[model samples]
Target: MTKTRIMIALVVLLAGLKSNGQEALFGGQEIVSPEINKDKSVTFRLLAPAADSVFITGDFLPTTKMKTPMGEMDAPGKKLLSKNGEGLWTYTTEPLASELYNYSFIVDGMTVRDPNNPFVIRDVSSLTNIFIIGGGKADNYKVNDVPHGTVAKRWYDSPGLGMDRRITIYTPPGYEDSKEEYPVLYLLHGAGGDEEAWMDLGRTSQIIDNLIAEGKAQPMIIAMPNGNVTQDAAPGMGSDGFYKPVFMAPKTMDGTYEANFMDIIKFVENNYRVKANKENRAIAGLSMGGFHSFHISRYYPNTFDYVGLFSAAIMPREDATGEVYNNINETLEQQYKNGLELYYIAIGKTDFLYKANQDLKKQLDEIGMPYEYVETDGGHIWRNWRIYLTDFAPKLFK
Candidate 1:
């Protein structure tokens, strides 16, 4: 063909491809799924013309009671989305409070994530779309125009577990540039979570960054270690490759993880520029991780001057047997004797472990052990956990 003919053909082909790409992406007109309004009421839109019905369910909605094997509990309520003439389904929530919320779409009985919303978080086995309502407590969770910290996933040798493990570390702003040695906080995750949990689900980095910038908290290093003893890291992130995650895993609450806790501290102290003493060391966790913190701090009596437990699972398994699990009272007695700056415990009012935490408080009272207790409204949820962290961090290393 001639040169002009070839140029004309190329132009035609490129134009066709561009048209098809736009059609595939937006289906003719652009669709913005989540549009945060000025009134704080969120409008969710989905382009599902062929679907018979559509509904939206999320943590922002009011909860209802649902029966499960454990017992009757509260679950996020579902709201029906009205279909538009163009097949665009939409629903607008009432003015929501400032907090982070996750939701999913139920289209024709199949549950799926919001295709237009790229922000999502994974909790164990499930993934859902997430959004933050600014102007309140959730503002701390959002990434703002502040001096940010560095988040890194580093691997370290764990001889006790007989495998290399991965941990997420957050070094505050100016850490690399400064020669200062900072205090260390060993943060842990619950069952079915890995090093990625606190960073993603709990918004640890963002919260800490905001708190530091606002002068509410001090600059420090946060080391988030995987609590699961059998796995080296999160699924698809470990040496075992990808696998399905479950709510419960073997050796989760066993004494093995607590006994080997020093390995993590050793790795952090050796690798990072941190203050290597009990007074500069702190530990905290949520759910299963809280249980681990409760046991590990006591096991290592004089290691940590600050400890926090949020919605902790207080009791171990019936068959759990080990020296770490045994002599809990004696260990706690020693921990108190060593002198702690802060022994903080926070939980939801309706949490499943409420009674257990009460029992623990009673035991501490009988021993005349001092601790700061906080009770908020909710169950075993991330909302309460984030609040607890926000409250507890301000009181650290002071």
Candidate 2:
């Protein structure tokens, strides 16, 4: 190419890089959205000169009634934002308790995330910005200076489901350096959640790392498998192309998942350096995953020495069928006969599955099945689940 032509092309490229449209899109000065004050109060801001109205919705806010497909129910509350002279909308809240919270902005009636905050999480299909208030229970949810563990996304063959699926595994610190074999904790997620649920939303790695460092919990390996039988992995992560996630998927609560549960256990035991014995193994889940924990623990009697159900769904599905679902009482009897080191059940008083868990306790009482029951405040929510894990993990593999 001629020198003149090359010089002209360079000039044109430089001009395009500094174009007005490009500047408007990426050249603006950055502003902080969520600013945590010394007193723990948070101030949220947004610059929208043309926006007619703005509001902030968050789980930490007060509860309000919202309509859903099922009916009008209590949902997270939103607060209006006031605009300053520079057209910057802002809102400040009273001191918040130490915990992780998710929030979204409603600008001109459209819900959006805080562009300034890079921290976010995806629950099902919805994504929201997240921040942590340190110095209490939330301290465990944050990444501190303690030794961190390794988290890997691995694919394992599931012959029962006729496909290769993904699983999230968390190996404790020093796992790779030491010659020790760790105990395994099979953590399951609820419906609509895939292998990534516990790792992302539950803060499993951070909590466990903090717990182990504090000497509150034993060092162990956590294996999270997708509970949805029809899915190979999280949305857009498997053979099925990119797709939106839903609250519930086909064959979630069915017996098929339980029937093929051994595949995950086998994969973990075969691949990882774990103690492959009942006394060294633990199983726990939340919501529908809790339901699976209940059935799987009983069906595979003498498998797990420690079992936990957090706000578990305990009702028997009449339509579901398989060897796992059959002879529930007989399986429970066998499980009790085999012996359990610790059977833990925790639930919030207002959880939808409270009555079912209570009934389960009653049946266990009839048979004199020993279990540790913890009843806390609130309903079926992540706050309770995180608390449950914090309380439950310290008691395992002891």
Candidate 3:
């Protein structure tokens, strides 16, 4: 064979080797390196099969329903580029000031993961790639040698609800060292979750231990309660109707959470060695827990000095009625003037609750209520809530 033919054969062999032994090609798409610039802008490229819409979705960007529409692509400081025949899509985003973000792709209305990024986090059954930027106070939220807190599973009977409920509580590292009374943060679990959700999945104790040891966060007791309100929604609900009736309601407003949640708080304060005053008391939760926080704190403003809602499900003005609305309006007005010390609302950009949170912020803004609104990365996942607690706890009792 001639030299040219030999060279052609060699090139074909190399291509065959790469195709057979190397990369796993899924829909012929591979994510290239994602680069973060000094301006905090992130530029990432993905090689994929030519499709109608190859939109990039992440914690920084809104979740697109159908990939092709790419509605409102002109997000401030965002740019998209695609090659004609190569099927390479590149995206450049504005400087994201968050510490962590999770994202995925929408191809023709179907959500898919980035093949290149190895760091993926699971949200229920779906998975998304995560990217972190601008490391903030949450850098110290790992397990450490500081006086570690202990997580215990405690059971309780709710007479009003006529059910036996279980709860998880975390005692600060030095609870046994001295008889000093500590403030307590009543954390609530979200929909489709149970009492042990915060400790088992959210890692409340570990985060607290690390934060307290580093002195970045205060050492306090955290009580995590089951936020499910349906009588059949305890851990082993056999029927689907008992799963999430609140979410399925006509307006998605939970009317049953207020009474049961208050009972749990009363139980914690009365039984535990917690400070009884509002200044030393707080309430916070995620998703459904967030709904509980907003409802509980607004109803019983004098009972808590700090209120945090992570991706809270704020009830619409039309939905609020009866005692719930009257209490929320009165309490919000009073708290706005008296100052609750801390009123925080945090949600991820890609989360479905982001727009709702923004709407709630707007309402608070209209009322001149003083509260912190944080937009971070990742959807409605425990990872985002864990980070929120880490940042939020230190700001309390200070």
Top candidate (TM-score)? 1
- Residue-wise lDDT of candidate 2 within 113-231, one digit each (tens)? 88778789998888999999998999999999999999999999999999999999999999999989999999999867889989899999999999999999999999999999888
What does candidate 1's lDDT look like per residue over 1-398, in tens digits? Answer: 99999999999877776665325634433567788999999999988889999999999888887774334556888999999897889999999999999999999999999888888999988999999999999999999999999999999999999999999999999999999999999998987788999999999999999999999999999999988889898899988888898777788777899999999999999999999999999999998899999999999999999999998888757746877888888989999999999999998987878888999999899878999999999887899999999999888998
Candidate 1 vs candidate 2: the TM-score winner is 1
Pull out the clashing pairs in model 2.
none
Q: How accurate locally, in lDDT, is each candidate? A: 0.90, 0.89, 0.69
Off by over 4 Å in 2: 1-29, 65-74
Q: How big is the positional error of residue 129 in model 3, measured in Å on the Cα after superposition?
A: 14
> Which of candidates 1 and 2 is the stronger one according to lDDT?
1
> How do all models score by TM-score?
0.94, 0.92, 0.63
- The CA-based lDDT of model 3 is what? 0.69
The candidate 2 region of ten consecutive residues with least summed lDDT is 20-29
Error of model 3, residue 331, in angstroms: 3.0
Which is better, 1 or 3, measured by lDDT?
1
lDDT of 1: 0.90
- Candidate 1 is scored at a TM of 0.94
Best first by TM-score, ranked: 1, 2, 3
